[model samples]
Target: MEFYGKGNLWNFVEEERRNMHFTRSLSFSTDQNVSEPHESPFVSPKASSASATSIPLSPMSPETPWKLSPMHASPSPSLLYHCLASLHRYEGNVFSIAISRDFIFTGSESSRIHTWKRPDCTEVGHIKASSPDVRAILAHGRILFTTHGDCKIRVWDVSVTEKFRPKKITTLPHRNPFFLFPKKNSHQHKDYISCLAYNDGEKLLYTGSWDKSVKVWNIFEKRCVDSFVAHEGHINAIVINQQDGCVFTCSSDGAVKIWRRVYGESSHILTMTLKFQLSPVNTLALSSSPSSCFLYSGSSDGLINFWDKEKTSGRFNHCGFLQGHHFAVLCLATIRELILSGSEDATIRVWRREEGHCFHSCLAVMDGHHGPVRCLAASLEIEGLLVYSASLDRTFKVWRVKLLTPEKAAMEELVVTNDQQTEIEECKMSPVLSPSWVEKKIQANHFQ
Candidate 1:
């Protein structure tokens, strides 16, 4: 079957894997070469076993506790940050990222699965299946739902622990897979499934696919509850606000449609539409707040547009726009009042919402990768303190806002002092003597 954007899609996935392998191999080789004696300059001499194992103690009460005076205390930095580890390396650019209560999940083009621990970013498991590429992943209750390029959606029962093993349960076939592509063997028929959303309270799974349709599935019954032709072109994204019983979908045809499902019905009734003709909407995210009722959507044109549900229509109704990314904006996440956006320009931007519907200027521009950032996930458990991002570079990065406590500050000080003392001792043990000492010894030898 043909697929829309097939060239770009295949290249994106292949580039990711190639970059990941290249970087890992380069680092490994560099470390190996640096281990040789002539290549390393900071190697320490082997220490005597007795000296290494022994630590002298002052004659003080064994139970005595150390106390710090107020004068010795210092203010700590508001945040500390570091890259813990890369979660997974994909052959295709990761298009979606989701974090459950315990595990981190990502969808990539190689038709493979990648998972890691929440917040820690430790690799847990992976699966390579026959599905066309996966575009989005949603975790609801014990089940994880994924949308793919094969015009099918799969449901998996995932273990909510460190092991992260997911068992495939059901696959919902597309009702109108042919709608995705008119020509057989055409590149447009690959049927890229772009988004997945679930209403666990109602036991429903909703998927947006390139077939230009949104499908609702009954999770318990393992059957499609309802299917609707919601877009004129490929449905690139979909998000369901279960709290409000509202589902939002966007397509390459350049429009955002909102559907409201009646409390007891299977079909979704169309409510409203937000139209933009310049670019296709690539991602969508809803705010948790009610009064603000804000929804953010990123587009292929690199502008992050904010829409307020309260404002119905017309020129003055737009909320605001985030303009910084040089290329297309691919993904977005909301953590409290902050909004995070990942772009094809190879940067992740953080923005904060201020009072009166306006957002503060960019809070931070995270940079470290050489390729486009394809997906981003923020920890709901950490109160907007940690962020995880996946890129076309074939790596996932975990970032945290460092919160330094009194204990951590003291430990850092102690570490610095110990390092300084070690450097001083090393200086004293050096083989070269001072010129003054050598001259005095030569004078004494002449007198003798």
Candidate 2:
């Protein structure tokens, strides 16, 4: 895409694309000779041998068949796989992750920002701003917008390189600042920004805050286009469905608000109101469809609720609730029919949407980090389905769903066998085995 304007913003996007191209070429050259293995785990000789029967067929049997039928082994486990490409370590928990065409940006509790490559997860740049805690990162074309605890939104140009790093081009601070969710009698509160999103096609940036408000800004003109008080409680997430020209926002008050920009006589009018309610909505995600729309929102009560825009009267009914993670769902991403969610329970769950009323089924449960998962992002480039998740463990992980190679399957099988043998050896050495050992000794003496 051709980025307009003549300054640092244009230069930065160009430089990032150049660097990405160079890295892509280098990776291709290095990975050309590495071929993936291709052995089928289902058709193993041991499995086939085990299927054979030891007893002869009975004459009274219907067919008098002695041999077992050729058994077709069960289909291999869906071939889903994940690999850690690079780890971005932070001082505190990472709250959100965003990716553009080239770079992956992460916001952390340390009030710092980090950028990395898409598939490789190579660190590209870093920035430390006055806002000590960053809550959201939104990237549109060439600019990266961040919302922080200082009750201000900062805009940075991500294309220009200064001292081998991208420099901040401009910063936009919030005009009216207040506590995120102020109590009835509390006056010393500042509204904390909970989420940020951008509609590049419309040149508009949106932010949701704990003050139960959603604000929109025009980046090209550098002014607030419109602002609306959206929810009764803290707004948790905001997502722009550019295809339908509808902006969706969810809040802790358990409601999802939809805003549409209506072209007025002179300027534009942001017609905003509550679209539906998915109580205690913590995360929001839109499907890839352009006409009939669907939204997936996760709640604080460990429920993933689905809402179909074309079916109900602007009301989100819980079509299906995925039950697995025990804590609050923090972030969610949808790519076609696949949905990936991260939660405070320190687990990442992948779900596939089926055709029936039961929309999604758990496909994989990734549990390695010892801390709560805070954010998730899905990448469709380089890897088919890549998931980047940030957690309270102070590390960001990259996971991709790919078919397992034969060599990997072999290695896993060997590891399983070794573990089984070790378990058997431990059982033999256990104190509880003394009685069995005496019985075995007596039987051996009698046989001899």
Candidate 3:
């Protein structure tokens, strides 16, 4: 037993060393080895227990005492990303993710949604909706909404957490209406519920499904209020702009449509139909800067279409494109002016908004997940960002990211800037960098 504080220097050092050893063990036991400074961004499929590279980004400064290493060795002009934690438990691909004030929810192909504590990846509870895949999740006041491949929308009352069990309040369609009314059957969605959105003020929930239909439900009533075949292909995602009373829906049919509620009419009007998109729109995000609000749509291809409100036309017009990801942009997350996109190429790209323009520059590429990234959630912190990424590889990782904090960034900019430095240059010069010679240079640059 030992005390910890200013006076207990030896005890603190011993505790820190144990923590370092524990973290290293977790990293190595999680089915991969530590990555070298050069061979980063992607963990090779051939990684073994014997191989290693665990370098934390926070240089052992007096202010901080922990381990972290940048996931991308290639300099991002002025940014760096570090892995904070990695959680692996699901048996299949992780499809969707949601972050609440107190919990983190992840839906997967294993037919369950796993719940963890907000600050750390501590297992708290889980709900097995059915034998089919849970494709999406939404957190409201006290209820958790989940869309499943079994073509159903399940409402979970999470307030009743007696034994980590959330009660399934009701399923849509309320059993079958055939007994009540033959024509109005109990069939809610014929295919799958792909996405969900909610409007707090209106007290309604919107769902998009693979049946090429969008359905509106009164959460309090647990009944489908309206249903319409709104797309030609399977609906991919839905997002609500409550301030403008706009419902944006994306589909595999390669189009995004906007709907608005009429004052007295029971049905919503199709206000706009965005066309000319050659690829199927897969996800949608609303980004707000100090000056304006913009809508971003991720596609089956690697392009993310940017649309801004046209003051003159009073409609959303195509502003430009944020083109970075090489494969399909599966998910998108926005925090203030920053945009994060996860793609089918098994990497996440961070982009910083240019303040006044619709275009954005790629800041860093995080390559740790071995499968296509399926979902991402980001929350702003006082100094940086806490980002969570879910992958089809059956694991979700938490990352800590900040831009331009190291004194060595300016000098290291010219040393290693891209992938070319990893293979040809490092192999050619590695033979000359001896242990003593490297140690001398590292000590001389202590400020880094």
Candidate 3 per-residue lDDT, tens place, 311-396, comes to 56758889788776655688998888788999766678888787776667777677666556789999866657889998654558
Better candidate by TM-score, 2 or 3: 3
lDDT of 2: 0.60
Best by TM-score: 3
* Alpha-carbon RMSD of each model: 17.1, 19.7, 15.6
- Point out where model 2 deviates above 4 Å: 1-75, 85-90, 160-164, 174-189, 265-279, 311-318, 355-358, 403-448
Candidate 1 residues 1-448, lDDT tens each?
Answer: 1112424444544544443444333433343322222211011212111111112222322332121211122333222333444443524356777788877777776555566656665555554456636788887667777766666677777766444446777666533455766433221234677788777568777887777878787777766777788988778778777566688898777688889887677888888888754577778887756546677888877888887665445111466788877666878988777788987666677777875666656655565455667788776544337788887665667766433466775454443333333432453233122233334333534654
Which of the two candidates, 1 or 3, achieves a greater TM-score against the reference?
3
**lDDT (C-alpha) at residue 430 in model 2:** 33
Tens digit of per-residue lDDT, candidate 2, span 1-448: 1111223222432333233322223433464344424312112223222211122211322321111101101122333444455353523457778887778888876555766766676565466575556888887766778777767777776663443255565555433237566334222125878888878677777878888777777777666667667778788898888775678888777777677777551133444444343447789998756445567887766778776664446444446567766556778998877788887556677787765344666766665444557789887765557878876555677766643355654443332333333432453233221233234333534654
Model 3 lDDT vs. the true structure?
Answer: 0.68
Candidate with top lDDT is: 3
Off by over 4 Å in 1: 1-81, 87-90, 161-165, 174-190, 311-316, 380-384, 402-448
Q: Give residue 230's lDDT in candidate 3 (0 to 100).
A: 90
